[model samples]
Target: MVAPLKVGIAGLGTVGAEVVRLIEAQQSILSARCGRGIKVVAVTARNKSKKRGIDLRGIDWMKDPLAVATHPEVDCFVELMGGAGDPALSSISAALAAGKSVVTANKALVAKHGVKLATLAEKHGGALNYEAAVAGAVPVIKTIREGLSGTSINRVYGILNGTCNYILTRMEQEGLSFAECLKDAQRLGYAEAEPSFDVDGYDTAQKLAILASLAFGTKVNESAVSVEGISTIAAEDLRAAADLGYRIKLLGVAMRTKTGIEQRVHPTMVPLTSSIAQVMGVTNAVTIDGAGIAPITLVGPGAGGAATASAVLADVADVARNVRALPFAQPVAKLKTTTKAPMERHEGGYYIRLMARDLAGTAARIATRLAEQKISLESIVQKHPNGGLEPIDGTKKSSPVPVILITYATSEDAMRRALQAVQKDKVISGKPQVIRIEKN
Candidate 1:
């Protein structure tokens, strides 16, 4: 057999150690598949003596992670050190400069600096592989890069964040509020103690930005993607969504429109019967709409050491076998930025919940506002006496009852204007909780 490929690893946290474990566990299979043995020869972390739940015997220790990437001892550089810049970026630069293959699980790095990195990798004749970056173990990147190579993909979108999904699933199933469900998720270790990144859809947005560039052959534009979180998804919103033949999910959407590309991450109401709706818990799923071929979807464990490590190892094997492909499934020069259209111009259905005065004509007043905006209601539910929660204070005693309405497909701008009018009325208390519904 050819000599084993020496791999250098940086970061021994959850994903880092898993890569080592997998390399050891799959040694035989990798040799057979890639025609070479593989081994992790060096590792770097803050503390050299730290116990990372794995045996660190016989491995070389590098105090500075950047040294590991630049060292001549390894043939490939594996970067599990996440973050868009600094050690991760600089170390990756050193690897590419040395003409060594680099593999990473950093979506933030890719979303923000993928184009430049791809350019550098190509310039140095170094391979930049990141199948693990988008959706943990799913070969969505590979499928689009290889399996569906012939098709022109127009849309690449899905549920990309597991923590958010788990929380949202519990909120609907247990009829708990967002805050309650989130606290439970944190206790279960499904979410980080500081959950802003996951709950706010920023994590999903980062992954979506990377997916958009690959699927559309466009330049990475993290700023172009609009993002919304699950923070405001009330229990009533989830309950009302269920009654409208839909289920709420934090969806990362990327689509090719004539005017420009539309990218966004938000709490979306999907048809209750769709396969995407049925996907629950800490699982990541992505669906690609190929122009001619059948739409393909992949869903699986999207986080943790075991799953993420599996991805890093697969990338290691590919580089060992000289798996040659474009840095981002396309040449950098071929990649262009998709025109970015505003969210208001896009057409979609919406869910609106309001606390209004219980008096007569209040409902008619709200309906007239919707008509003025050219928005039509697909369904309306006015609870004569919504006893579950009192209408938020300050509204007139004659305020309309808790009014929930599902509007037909309309412009986002129109919906916002209509909602503004509804909330401004003294009879209605607080802003009408609104969530958009997508047929997909």
Candidate 2:
């Protein structure tokens, strides 16, 4: 048998500690699979006294994190550290510069500086693998980078954030308010103390950038994605979605358009019958649309110690097996400079909700505004009034009623212009609620 492949690990957090335990428990299986034993030769963390439920016997303990990356006996460096800068960035660069293969679960690091690190890895003849970076254990990265290599991919999208998904699912199923669901998520440890990163759409945006690069053979562009959070999604929006045969999900979408690549992360309305809608409560689902084959959707647990560690081990095993592939599934020189497609150029169906005075000819005015922009409505629904209004000056009082309109395929620019015209007519109250519709 070949000598055991030595590994070094940094950041022994939830996922990192589990990775150590898992490698020991599955040692025999991994060895058989890779034709050699996989061993954790060294480890590092913030506190050495922290009691992790794993034996660290016979392994080198490093006080300084960077030493783990450049250790003499270490064949591969596993960075479970979660950060976009500092130790994570400098350490990974040191590992590649030392000609050591790297496997990391840091999406922020990969999304922000993937091309430069990838180029460094290639220059040093080192493999850089990150199966656990996006969507946890879903293996979506490998599926795009290898499984569909020969095909031409048009689009890749999915529910990439588990915290937002859990909140949205609870809101829809239990009819809870956004705040209520968010509190529940925090209690359940699904959300962080500071939840803005996940709930405000930046986490999903980072993951989408990595997926876009793999799917389109383009350089990762974290700043290019248009992002919107689930903070403003109300119970009424959920009710409206269900009434229209759809379910609301926070989605990260990347598509190739005529002008360039379009990447967006926002709350979306997908058909109730769609497979992605069926994925609920902290689970994730990713779909890849490629030519000459039907769309393929991969759904599974998006997070947790065991799931993420399993993904990390898979990449480690691949490295042990001497697998060599570019980080973006194509040569760095061949990767094209990405042109960001403007949101105004997006063509799609939309769900628009407006509150207007309950009076005759109000709907006609809205229709006229839409018509002026050449936006055609697929359906118009006028919900019942909120309540009877009190009479003022002995005149019949009018209450505001909810008017919901589903538009056919139209440009976002046209929708915005039409809504501006409608708002100017003084028939509407408050800002209009608009959610984009995804047919597939």
Candidate 3:
């Protein structure tokens, strides 16, 4: 008889507890699939006495994460304590050093210390699986690392953060301000009290780094990603996007470019009919453009205990099946070094929302600056306070007027230079809101 795969899990928080319950509840299904039973032999958490609504009887309760990682009977160590540093890092390292397979849902750890950890796993002949680190329950890691390994991937982009997506969805659907939507998201448990990590695009950047490494055979480098958050996005931007046949989404995009692999996270203007724009709320989605094939998009619930645990258990099952794949889709030594791509050199269409000073020659000066930069406007609209549009006739109004400009494909440098001239020329009231238009 084949021995069951003994599992040790650290951190009995929401995700950890759910993992245990899932293993027990789906034991028969998992066993049938992996050709062996799966068992939770050991576990550890900060608080053992807390009521987690799951039974942990017969499971060895270790004193700490390191103990669980180094447990003699554990065949696989699952790290659910989410931080880029120890003891999650140390424990995962210890498990890999011990030749026990390691699974985790820590994107930050993977983003920061992935190469080091993968090197450890390689040296010790153990598997390092972090299917839950990026998009929860999406199976994107497996898709990119194994399923599409035969295909050449050119671009990978998506809405990776549920909190930001939820906030943006509310802002667009209810016409709420970013602050208002963020407050509601917090109250609904979709956002943390300190939501800067999610809203500021850092969360998406980390996930994008992981995906970029997998897709492009590069090392995971979060610092290489150019990041911009959704905090600056306003209700007006979303409304204007609707008027212009686009939807504003916070997207993390990594693509092959002439300069190198370009990784960026920001509020992007996606066409209304695109697959990514159809996604809303807390749901996460990733679209992969590969050579010799149509684009592949994976969509699912990105967070929550059940969704994350699903991915964690899937990684555990791969260990149970004795499936050992390279951690970053290749040996760490072969993974190329990634440098930060210059955002100024990025070429794309742009959406510029300017609060133009309603004075004579203001419109002409703005147009002249863009023209000097060789930027051609695809469309331009002067928005009235009540969501109406008037021609840009340089007509003075009671206050500053909202002028929306959609430019054809242009370099970020040109757009920046033009906007700077507009600002310096005192033709705009406040900073011009700029969102890059992503081509589908």
Best candidate, TM-score: 3
Tell me how many residue pairs clash in candidate 2.
0
TM-score for each candidate, following the candidate numbering: 0.94, 0.97, 0.98
Q: How do these models rank on lDDT, best leading?
A: 3, 2, 1
Judged by TM-score relative to the true structure, which candidate is superior, 2 or 3?
3
Worst 10 residues of 3 by lDDT: 388-397
Give the lDDT of residue 260 in candidate 2.
88
Per-residue lDDT of candidate 3, residues 170-240 (tens digit): 99999999999999999999999999999999999999999999999999999999999999999989998
- The best candidate by lDDT is 3
Error of 1 at 356 (Å): 2.8
Cα-based lDDT for every prediction: 0.85, 0.91, 0.95
Each prediction's RMSD to truth = 3.1, 3.3, 1.1
Regions more than 4 Å wrong, model 1: 338-340, 384-400, 425-427
Task: For candidate 2, write residues 1-440 as lDDT tens digits.
Answer: 69988999998989999999988999889988999999999999999889998899999999866999999999999999889997999989999999999999999999989999999998998999998999999999999999999999999999999999999999988889999999989999999999999999999999999999999999998998999999999898898898789999999999988788999999999999989999999999999999989999999988999899999999999999999889999889999888567899999999998887755677889989999989999888766445222212222237777778899999999999999988888888889999999988
Sort by TM-score, top down from the best: 3, 2, 1
Q: How many collisions per candidate?
A: 9, 0, 0
